[model samples]
Target: MTDIVVSTDWLADHLDEVRVVDVRDGWEFDGIGHIPGAVNVPFDTIRAAEHAVERGADPAEGMLPGVETWEEVLGGAGIEPDDTLVAYDDTHGVFAARFLVTALAYGHADVHLLNGDFSAWSRDHEVERGTPEVEPTEYVARESETSPFVDFETVEAALTADDVAVIDTREPDEWAAGHLPGAIQLDWRELVDDDSRGLKPDAELESILADHGVTPGARVLLYCNTARRISHTYVALRHLGYEDLMFYEGSLAEWEARGAPLESA
Candidate 1:
């Protein structure tokens, strides 16, 4: 899997070459200005929101669906496998970064997350209003995700494993609310810094992961209430050369649904 990110300046220079996607809520896209030529692909559209609605799943859960659904959602946004995609969010890069991860899971290789997001980009970049039209394409998913993502079963098995590191990338309150029995706390926001509030310097990032016992050699599973917050940490660790990184997309909420015990620590 490719572990690279693009800066706002670079995106501005090649807006014509790259497919710029805004992954904010639909209302936010209408109310807030966006990058010129950018198309809306709200984060939920790429996730399992539809599936959740059909099955009566939790409203806040954000996870992936089947490949067919992914292909349709992406194609509807004019996304093709060969196109270079750069996604950004109005607030945090969670939605934007998740966009990149979701694309990879659907076999789209040329994807990127805009470093500073819309807030960082809008400070000096060109902004536009109104929506843009996009013609759907016949895109097909060739694989799931290139990065490691575990099912609830796999995560449960790892819970007792000595070598595996399970990290809870939620806020302290979320942690205190209730979490997986053996998860260690590591807030996602603290691991990143900069005007964009993205990943910090490589050295600092390394230190954060190291402190959490999530070194390159460790088999790590990261998660939050939903998958969005954890994805921010996943991106940072992936860039730090943590190949054994795994995303527990189901997270603790899914775990509880499975009758798994929780620890209110």
Candidate 2:
């Protein structure tokens, strides 16, 4: 298992050692059973309305909450700064990856995504129907030494830089509507396994990325409609050893709101 991804089998063995976070909605957490002892950190908990307001972007755009918000949400969920976290969701790990990215951005050193979805886990393993009691911890969120997040201006500047490759990780319909100029469209779904709902093998992932000229040596910038879907691709690239990575936080939402140039293919 890679540092960012942990298989079901590995998770089964290490369940006691790590905190399992279910990023699915609250209804799913109660109606659809979840991994035993996992805490349901609903998908919306990590987002804040103020992010858009603070950035002067569209209020409709989803954005990561501030560090204090993250600290409250994570600490209230009983997750400590040093705790190893394993996040999972039913949306082919997209939601889970978002939580992982949020944690990493807040300076959490140890975080991982469950290789498969909650359904996969319930198929062969035991699940619990109710919420588990959690002892809240005092989680201190440190300033990120090197954040993966990037602003709209930084991405705009990179549009003309030869050394950087901008990638749009949205769906075909979204891409068809509009996208950043010079941005390559590689739907985030392409990196996922159809059968397992997990990431594709590293070899296959590398080949697909290589075909798009997104090599390890190039500084890669990833963005989606609101920075949610691209989180999956971000984790995939990290697993493949793409060290120089940047995420456009506001994404196309900010771009369009700011009247930035866009091209349709």
Model 1: per-residue lDDT, tens digit, 117-226?
78888888879887778898988888655755666777788888898888998888988889887788998787667565566778887787778777777888777765
With a 3 Å backbone cut-off (N, CA, C), the pairs that clash in candidate 2 are none
Q: Runs in model 2 with CA error above 4 Å?
A: 50-62, 251-253, 256-260
- Per lDDT, the best of the predicted structures is 2
lDDT of each: 0.75, 0.83
Pairs that clash in candidate 1: 105-144
Worst 10 residues of 2 by lDDT: 53-62
Q: Residue-wise lDDT of candidate 2 within 1-265, one digit each (tens)?
A: 3578889889999899998999898899988889988988998989767457446753323377877888888888888888899999998898899899888778886899998899778777898897778899898998776468876677778888999988988887888789888888898889999788888998899899999988878899888765568888888888888888988766565567778889998
